[model samples]
Target chain A: MNSYPVTLKQSYSSALQAYLADAQEAALMRAYELGRQATENGLGVLDIAAVHQEALTQVLRPSSPSQETLQTVQAASKFLAECIAPFEMTHRGFREANAALKQQATQLANLNKELDAFAYSVSHDLRAPLRAIDGFSQALLEDYLDKLDAQGVDYLNRVRNASQAMGRLIDGLLKLSRLTRAEMRRQPVDLSATAQAIAEALRKSQPERRVAFSIAGGVTANGDPVLLQVVLENLLSNAWKFTSRHATATIEFGATWQDGKQVCFVRDDGAGFEMAYAGKLFGAFQRLHGRNDFEGTGIGLATVRRIIDQHGGRVWAEGAVDRGAAFYFTLEP
Target chain B: MNEKAILLVEDNPDDEALTLRALKRNKILNEIVVARDGAEALDYLFGTSVISGQDAPLNPEIVLLDLKLPKLDGHEVLKRIRADPRTKLLPVVILTSSTEDEDVVKAYGLGANSYVRKPVDFDQFSEAVRHLGLYWLVLNVPPRSKGR
Candidate 1:
């Protein structure tokens, strides 16, 4: 049917004329229905007021008696007030919702500021004590080595190792937080080159691991280069770590079509996790493997998920116990 | 006072002791002048207060400044150090635990000669200080002080 302000104007004129001619309750209900229909047709309060003014000029002619004109004006105001009632209620609803939304926004802004201060203190103040623990332990090992027995020396070494491991954990935590807060500069990023660079770094880190890398060329994306690098580094490094036990292993980096969209993937024939534990993959510090099996702070997949989420993409995994694992992700805007 | 003493501006006693030991191990045997806070650092460098017990500012060979300090912070101290004509060209190296990008930007913007995060691993921290000492003190030449 026709949905226009012209329809509203015509309906409003007829309703007012009917009400003036009959002076009945049914006529007043028509005036109310006209107001509701005008709102539905996307007409504003001013538009309805203009329609009502036009109707009044034609209804009240100068030839009518002055006393009769007074009565007609008063009676017509009753119908006009009923018509304007719906518009006032809608405006009131808008004001309430707007105020509530503003209040929620203010609360969120304050929470963000507090989180920034907390992260700053954690970065600056917390490391000093950890450094002192590691530094003093080193001093004891260097200066009092002759005084301590073999077992005592071993204990000191353990203390130093524990402190250093804690240092690594703190560093990892800082890195994750920093990446989330970092400013993103999105551009066309070369995913193939990014994956290749990470693979090279991993190979150089452990030259004895006889791992084969099958990275597809021309894999590209539109995302923040630095953040996309983090995603590839985490996934590839995880692949490299899980495959350390094998004398020789193969890892692949490529993309494929999924539901009519391009999806990037990293797959490895490594110590793949069971499908039962796959639900815990993207959580921070979530690990399906034991520490002795693979040494990690359990932040790699979590970091990858965070970056992908910020890019408005989704990440998922598929694996079978000891068979292999494949990670698929998409980058949109 | 006339000796090319090294001024160490630090707040934490542990870091102060650790840094001193690191420097001494590197054979940086210059006379060390330690200021425990930013205000004391300014007092020693400008003779702003009688607490330092020097008649004039003790222009050290280098100032190893820490960012987080009591009474005054590192950035404000660097601002004042660069503001004064006598100490404007003084070499100030920021040594702190913060690797935050904004802190790095602010330090360099305020005329910091170098920025180094105090590594948690003592071996790496020791090596970093050793190279730092050899580079800034032995190799890098200091300009003649304008306050002279």
Candidate 2:
């Protein structure tokens, strides 16, 4: 029952009065001006309709002759239609903006694909020069072991080590970039089996690392098996690596029902990170520990996040400074 | 001991030299023939290089093929090798960087005997070269020369 904007109400009343006074084209012209003013005042179609109805009710006399009332009603309808001209124009404006937005989206997608191809080509070619550097450094060491002093040999070895480190970086970045470009195949994958297999392989790779894995059996998920495997590999390997200092540690993997959806988590009792820097943990090349304490390219969690995101899931981490770290993800429809 | 030459189809001079050094250090004493491009490799195998005045093809005991090259890349060379009856059975081992590379899968599909990822660490790479030499040259017997 509250009145509309006072200025809109006043202008609408005057416009109707002028229309009734002569029913001339000039009087109706004021109706269009009223619409533009209404829009400027942030009045919508509903507000304008309210204003028109109230103005017409006041202009009509209940005691008027039927003939005069009919004429007044017809004139009032025409004025209302004219007053909504700005609303129609607003609709057309939205449609055109939407079309432009869609076109730009398509252009952006094409540009992203081109960027991906360029990055892939660059990463592919980068390996050759890196390999040559390492190979030549090795050649220097093997071919001239006795001719050079220990310091020279050490320098050559260092060169080889640096090149190999770059190789690892390139590999990590390549894998990271390809996550988006690769075609994903969704299937019913036995996550437990994949986790067990990864655990077995990790143990085989370094048998001296004492760690116990507690993985739930029959854990399945509908996703791209190859991609899910990558997620588990990165997460589990992170757990295995961070726990290297402990004589014995525990790593757990399983899923649980959280708010009626399946949430999977990987947890390890290892050298955990601070809650303050937890946000930076999933960023590429963002490391929390020094290289001397831990060896990683800081790509593992980022890889996990990307794959989970591709699967329409969310991933997050929780940890303290020294207790341990736990990563959780949810896959839902 | 296999006396035939080993054809190395490589475009990068650094890779070519490194492969030579790796194989030589591993006691792969077979004569190593270098072809700098895919076309040159095809030329050596088909013996069609009239400019070089070679009339007969010298079949290598094994071909260490790289994926990327200047002309006719590795897959094209592999296809031609399989297409021709003379060199169809030639044992070609692919040298790649990583298993993640899809090119390795395509290489396997094109009838490669084995693939060795070239590790950036020199010692690991040397070990890989040694294993390849041991597997192909010493342990496994080469197919009898086909009426050459």
Candidate 3:
């Protein structure tokens, strides 16, 4: 592209100069002089100064370099070098500008990732207290509403309801943030011990419930502890919560090897959700049961799904309304 | 006989109140000496020019250092404490709100004996204080004291 432009400009200017030097064609010579002045003043079709000396030599003599032509070549070379200097500088500047723009784009992407992580951490950390506040407040209102005057009871109930809704909003925000921030760490996790601890805690929460809770031992997998805990917590908490309706609530937390991958499941016998809405089970704020029937922020399953994805794993649920729900998750080998 | 002393270095009033309440609730029977900022903590620790009117020369069994503080930060205070032979190996425990891994690693690197993340919830916060006081005061044996 560069060589062709230089050649064309040289040819065009050489033709004009030839016309200017002609004796018989005085009118054409006058026209050529006028065109040359206009070109010098930046009023013509091209800048003659920009043409290369080699291109001028090609226009003057199509073949061979000569001793007499050397002076003309040098003059042409000087003019061409002067004209091309600014453009070369400009081209270099443009390259630097483009590189800077690319660097800024990378920095912006990094900042966005950090912001997502910050939002996730904040939301998750904040919810623990909000849980204690909302849960305990509701318990207070439900268990001791009669001792207080009407207005006082109403105020406490309002506080409880508002906090519960805030909990839902917080949970949703946390899931959205976790979609970007959550990263997978693969390490061998003793699933049996984790399940047993969760089961014992659940049973301790309700001693008289008479639930036959069983967790198979020796189940292990490689995954991020925090994310895997989220999966287990959600699944086991769901199982424990749902099975509250049964007189003999039976729940099992275990893992089985399926197709060379560890497949963990939390199986329960209680108010299981319908299979029709199973597709929406992992969606944020998508609740299978009514708020009155089941107490949930509805962000649990969404978190479970996100954590599994971070591990490059998969999650699914199977259940029939009023029978039971079983959530299955798989981790990399 | 030296009355057992604890140097509580904290900035925020609410946090200070919460911490004091937590300590008291956990039956930490030591005479608690409070420093509102890092400068004050230093003054009490090293007997700075601002607080030279010593009723007695100050020496605390344990310094509960909070990482973030106004004026001089927790790091500066820690450096000052560790620099002097009198207070070197004084069993500093960093108690802070931040759970950032860098801070954890840095605190331990700076010769802090233990690092405890300050829990946000009231009950949990109090429980952590209880365990902390019990562990530092009764369980872990302090090095033999140098003559004052």
Candidate 4:
């Protein structure tokens, strides 16, 4: 009887050791299935522990049973039961967590749909009144010009200006929301050529401004072309706007190797901000400069941050007052 | 002088007035039939509703369709217009304040001849109306109407 139990326990132990040694996920699953089968066939945890103790006792004493051996078996049984309890609890916890995660994902998807619909309606509805205000004001200026005084005309123009500014704000908000909702398509994009083109357009728009652009050759990235263009537009436009006061300005676009990864940068000799306010740079409507100083809706940098984030990239700026600013970004290789 | 009447399908009274002003300012003096809602627009086009009587202008030169309306939407109206043989080839321009990409793609997919986002500045809006009126009313040739 001692020999039979010893051989059976040795075979089971060896099988378990072989599977554990391989450490394959499938093998562990197989082991779990075997464990379940063994338990279901009238072999409880206590019985399994009793078998282990019997195997040890058989190995120690080849032919005879003793009171000392029985005591040892009881102690081993209690210890094995305690060891197995936590694993069962952990398995139950994992199942509950997975189910909860699935529920949350569904809720998130529904909320996104609701948000898209809300944005669409808001974009459509909000602009109508703005157009009316601007349009009617223009009408007053045009039709009632003979009867109205210069002050009246100025007031109407101010109303038109305010409404148009509001229109721009609404457009900016819509663009930001749309960026969040838009699907991204990734491909290798010629970022240098894109920057050069935008720079050329800026130059053409204001030929009197002597701004030199230095774009690195073959500087490319993997991202959605349209979104990347938006990024370049925002960054380059900022450079253009801030450098307007300078007699001559320089804007450079290039990439450098940092931490074994490629980091692209846009450097501009423009009106740089204080380091203390840098934290608020990428927030929507966060303007470091006064409206009188810089004409902006303050949505451009926020949009740039959002686009880069969507591309699984990072963006940061380094600047000092009147020294100029440089923006650096990185994408996954 | 252009004999074919133009259809201005807009919901908001303010927009309607502004759009009419824009057209007048641009010297687009073609007869314009105004529809306040998508349902009324469809009725005017298809002559299927109680309001579609002898006075309704059926064969419009161009349809300036707004996306958001009180009773049916622009998409539904465009779909009905495209589905019918009589109005299938009629030039329909999507004139709205929405610069959304989805709206543009959907409008084109639904067989819109053109899409123009209404500018907030009256001067720009007037210029856009002028170009639209000049192009659709005077320059572009229309397909023969069914003469219902």
Candidate 5:
């Protein structure tokens, strides 16, 4: 009957309306969860978008859907899309930032490699001409000694000395650059034994000088033996050199606990530097004293700083002018 | 017996002059043949060019080779000399200005009889040359030549 058909249509419309509401609620919940998960996992925009499209399809695919149901599905899909817009933008920003960081890392590595190659070539090429200059000066001195006056010979000697000093500078520069390029191998190094040996050598070099050395026994550190030796040599030699003018100097190589960390120090009773110029102490070619007053290339402390930095350590100096200086360094365990 | 001859392979004219002067100062007094580059050195040793067109090939007692050369590096030249049966045991000494550790290890690995770093100090250089000449030319006897 016509009445029965109308009743049946009414019931069907009510059921479809209820089903659409439930579907919309469930889809919204799922979308909220997906957005949360995407944000947590740092999921890409395209990946979340694909997942969202699949979810929308599942939500939209209904058996015997009416015209009103189809419209609701379209409306729900648009809402879900808008909901994910903020997440998509955030993911895009993260991806771009990560890419930029990777690019910067690669650029830094390439620049370091180029610097190493430049240093190597400079060491090789520069030494050749320097050797030539020094050698020819020697030849002139030996062969034409009688032809030239004493003043002329003295000038040639000065030239030779200057070239030799330049050679030492080049060698120091090469060593400093190599420290940056060389791979570090860490092991337990006997700091006490190394310090004692260096002190012995320094004493032997100048037997006339009376310097008391107190090296702490059983002091150990984890670092490259060769590099650590270089560090000690520079520190101890600096101590020895600066203390030369003293009537009797005392150099102490010891380690003490400071702030729950082992701090190693090289202390000397000699001509210390002013606190004002302390900032310039570790810079390459930075000399507090005149070249005439002290013979040095001023690259030693710079090399020390570089080596310590490579070892993941810190170094600093403390002193007053004309007073003794104490250099302290610490290595990470 | 004819005084033992020496082959001085050096490309840099200044280095060549200094080496020659050092050798003379050390009183080496041996017949010295100067080759300007690696190719010329190979030519002299292998008897392949105008320098080696005589009836008999020139056989030097020792070869003082510089590392950096024009055509071939000292390592490559050393490898070739070691590969050849005639010059394999020719007492080749690597005499160069390179202080690089890799150069030293490579030279020795390539079967170099001696690896000497050319000192910057002329006096030390002369002293090193004196010791080298005394040791290689006079003290240590060379393997009998195949031609001999």
Candidate 6:
């Protein structure tokens, strides 16, 4: 063996030496960093060698029997290999968790896209058959009204009415679907003005019906103005329809402070449903009354429920059969 | 009375017939030019395509545009109409079956003069059409025809 300079020899971790051995001579000094790290971790030769082969090989380079470098690098590498198992396990666990989360996110995104497509198809497909029914019924009435007797005319009328009701149902479904797809814009809405406008519209719709309205001033809520209008319109219209037989009908719009939050209410002296059906009140196409008693698509309350839910609110109804129905809805903070 | 004609751009034959019937029923007769789609509407207004057969000026009093059409939707048509300085101030009444909040907001934001939703009820639809036609034809004065 040739004699080496006193300061020329050094130890290395196996991994560091392995890397340096594959690299050029210029990379050996930089690769020695792993040996220092292994030493700092209190690793012995065999453990470091198994974990960091590159560093050990470089430092153990047998140029001219550098006995000092060979012994040091081998010891450090052997020591480091044992310490790496726990760290590697923890890293692998994290990698698996990350991969799982990514997969779940992709699945959720796909589900959302599928739901949107389904809504679109349902809305489009349902409208076509409804239109045909309405169109054909009207055509029959126009073409064969003279050939048919009173009974036939009545049958046609019923057919037309049923088709119209179906149309309303389709429209309601579409509205709900659109609401789901729509981007909501929240702003401060003047409840009093909104109520007044709805009241005015109701009055215009039935000029002969004398229905008095009371909207308390300074009542406001944060929501989409257009959607809130729909909410108010449905609630008020329901009140009006229910109270049609009443000699004197009164409708009130106001809000009350409940649990430190404003809970708005629409109260009317109208034909309200029994309390037993309250559970199904917000279900789509769930009507509490017979079609002959009061005409409705049964989706009004469902629409209201969806709107309230979107606004982060809750809706509930309180009333008896012939007394009055009051709907209370509150938006969350 | 402005000599400029009113352009009724509608695709459905039944809807077109009903609209014409309403206009006639209202008795506020102005020279009406009906185009079946957005393309035809543009052609009539620009004096291009089939409108070249007639010697009348291309300027229209108002454009009654439907949102949903077979070829070229209403929004794109509205954009094109607004982009041209010649038709920029033209009043476009968006008469459509869409009563969605987004549709209303978009039509108004696009500078539609009026946005009327088509009532599903036959009588109500007819009345709306009549009133709209009368208001645009007789009551509202058209922009000056000096440019054309």
Number of the top TM-score candidate: 5
- B21-57, model 6: which lDDT tens digit per residue? 5566667577788889889888877667595466443
Q: What is the interface RMSD of candidate 4, in Å?
A: 0.8
- How high is each candidate's TM-score? 0.80, 0.75, 0.58, 0.80, 0.81, 0.60
Off by over 4 Å in 6: A1-156, A181-276, A311-333, B1-5, B28-32, B51-57
4 versus 6: better lDDT goes to: 4
Residue-level error in angstroms, candidate 5, position A325: 1.5
**TM-score values for chain B across all models:** 0.94, 0.91, 0.92, 0.92, 0.94, 0.88
C-alpha positional error of residue A101 in candidate 2 after TM-score superposition, expressed in Å: 5.8
Candidate 6 is graded, for docking, as incorrect
What is the C-alpha lDDT profile of model 5 across B51-78, one tens digit per residue? 6565455678999999999889889998
True contacts kept of each: 0.83, 0.77, 0.00, 0.93, 0.47, 0.00
Tens digits of per-residue lDDT for model 4, A79-183: 887787676566557767977999998998789778867876887688888898999999989998998999999999999999988888888988888887878
Q: Which residue pairs in candidate 1 collide?
A: none
lDDT of 1 by residue, A189-282 (tens): 9999999999999999999889999999999999999999999999999999888888889999999987877799999999898998887999
Off by over 4 Å in 3: A1-112, A120-230, A252-264, A274-299, A330-333, B26-29, B49-57, B100-102, B138-140
Candidates sorted on DockQ, descending: 4, 1, 5, 2, 6, 3
CAPRI quality band, candidate 1: high
Query: For each candidate, what's the DockQ?
Result: 0.80, 0.53, 0.10, 0.82, 0.61, 0.12
Q: How much is the lDDT of residue A198 in candidate 3?
A: 79
The candidate that achieves the highest DockQ relative to the unseen native structure = 4
For every candidate, what is the interface RMSD in angstroms?
A: 0.9, 1.4, 6.8, 0.8, 1.3, 3.5
Candidate 4 regions with alpha-carbon error over 4 angstroms? A1-113, B48-57, B146-148
In candidate 5 chain B, what residue range of length 10 has the lowest lDDT sum? B49-58
Per-residue lDDT over A1-333 for candidate 2, one digit per residue giving the tens place of the 0 to 100 score: 234478788888888988987899987888998888776655677677777766776676555647677676767766776778787679768867988999998998799789877767777788889989999888888878989899999998889888988889878888888887888888899999999999999999999888999999989999999899999999999999898888899999999988888888999999999999888988988899998899988888888888898888989899986688999987664
